[model samples]
Target: MSLAALLDLRGEPALVVGGGAVALRRARTLLGAGLRVTVVAPDLHPDFAALPVRAERRPYLPADLNGQRVVVAATDSEAVNDAVTAGARAAGALVNHAGDATRGTLRFPAAVERGGVQVAVSTGRELPMLAQALRERIAALLPEPGTVDAWAARREEAVRLPGAAREGALDALRADIRSAFGLSAGGAV
Candidate 1:
């Protein structure tokens, strides 16, 4: 079964077991999510220089997964990726295998974010192109980055109201959203 979830992995530690293009992409995404990522590979990719990651230009060690919250097995060798998967399992960390998604427990879905709001689409990693297309469509429909921020600021004041006052404020906010986003009175997004 596939479940799509938006996780707050900020300040968590993650490990990438490769230095190739796939691993580079995974590392960037992890960093973007505010993870403290460490990449281990025999030859660190030159592109990793710009990213804020602790790069170790050495072969992967099972102990590398010791304190990682998430792991990505993106090494070139299938056997090595399998080893990384085993290590992640032993360390009780979520693992994602780049070469074959089914072997790993986690799937990185197509995602878009504006302020604190995030939308993700996943086809169980079976049809990535479709997921990408859906993500693109959704991205185009999103409001500007600070639009959600502005709404959240208003929400902070609305929640402070007492009893029925709070309900009224919230109702107004809902109507504002519907008006701004061209949503129906039924509250469909």
Candidate 2:
């Protein structure tokens, strides 16, 4: 079975071994996760001009994996992507192999964040269409931002209360959970 988890990988060093559309997508996701990314390729996609990643106008070298904790093998060349996967694995870094997702240790999920609520869906083997469909379905089910804010405030306050008091506070919050998003008092969001 696959395990789902939320990780805090901020400020970690990462590498992307491509510069095409696939590389662009992977780079954006890595950047969002707070990873300091460096993309190496002899040529780059036109869209890459807008991203804040470190760009290297050169071919990928195994030496590039140095100090990287995360790697994405997103080049159009399968051989290059495979090499990236091997190098990253040997370096003990989590790798996302775009050419063959199952061969890599990590597969990025399609995600949606709203009102501080994050929903992610992953379909391994690079089934992006499936993952995206599920992500959209889940996003449509999210509550309004106000409901999340109310819950967040309740959580913050409850942290200072005793166990019994905290339970009571949480119970009250649940009873009035409609506080927003598409949620309703007598119906569902």
Candidate 3:
């Protein structure tokens, strides 16, 4: 079974071996996570230029996998994707095949961020569309970004409450969160 966990990618070097829409999407997500991303492709779509990533206009080289913590293969060519997977494994880096999960060991989940809370949904690569649908459903149940500061403030005060009142304070915080998000008391996202 594939285990689910959140990784800290800030400041880590990552390589993306494509310049198409799939590669662009993966690169954007990685860049958003603060990773130092370098994308290698013979030709790039115009949209890629807008992102803050190091773009190398060249064919992917196996050596490009070196020193990378993560590598994403989004090339259209199966041979090129295979080469990237092998190179990433040999270099001890995690590999993601954007076209198909069976080609690599890593896959990204659909993510939703709201009010300082982030939720990710994975269907084990069985159905990406379902994961995205689930993410959308969960996003609607989360508090808005503007409410995050208030939630944090409540948490801070609750953490300092006396032991006897701690649980009640925490429960009240949860109730507030539920009310703000239009979720039922038993709802979970």
TM agreement with the true structure for every prediction: 0.90, 0.87, 0.89
Per-residue lDDT of 1-189 in model 3, one digit per residue for the tens? 787888997999999999999999999999988999999999998999899999999999888998999999999998999999988988889899877788787889999997788999998857989999999999998766778888788889989989969778888888887877667887542
In candidate 2, which residue pairs get closer than 3 Å at backbone N, Cα or C atoms, i.e. clash? 143-181, 144-181
At residue 134, give the lDDT of candidate 2: 92
Question: Each candidate's lDDT (Cα)?
Answer: 0.89, 0.87, 0.89
Clashes of 3: 0
Q: Candidate 2 on 115-160: residue-level lDDT in tens? A: 7899889875458899999999988888767778878788789778
Per-residue accuracy of model 1 over 1-189 as CA lDDT, tens digit each? 876677889999999999999999999899999999999999988999999999999999888988899999999999999989877877889999888888888889999886666889898748989999999999888878788988888889999999999988888888888887787656633
Give the per-residue Cα lDDT of candidate 3 at 50: 92
What is the model-wide C-alpha lDDT for candidate 2? 0.87
- Highest TM-score model number: 1
Stretches of candidate 1 exceeding 4 Å from the true structure: none
Worst 10 residues of 2 by lDDT: 180-189
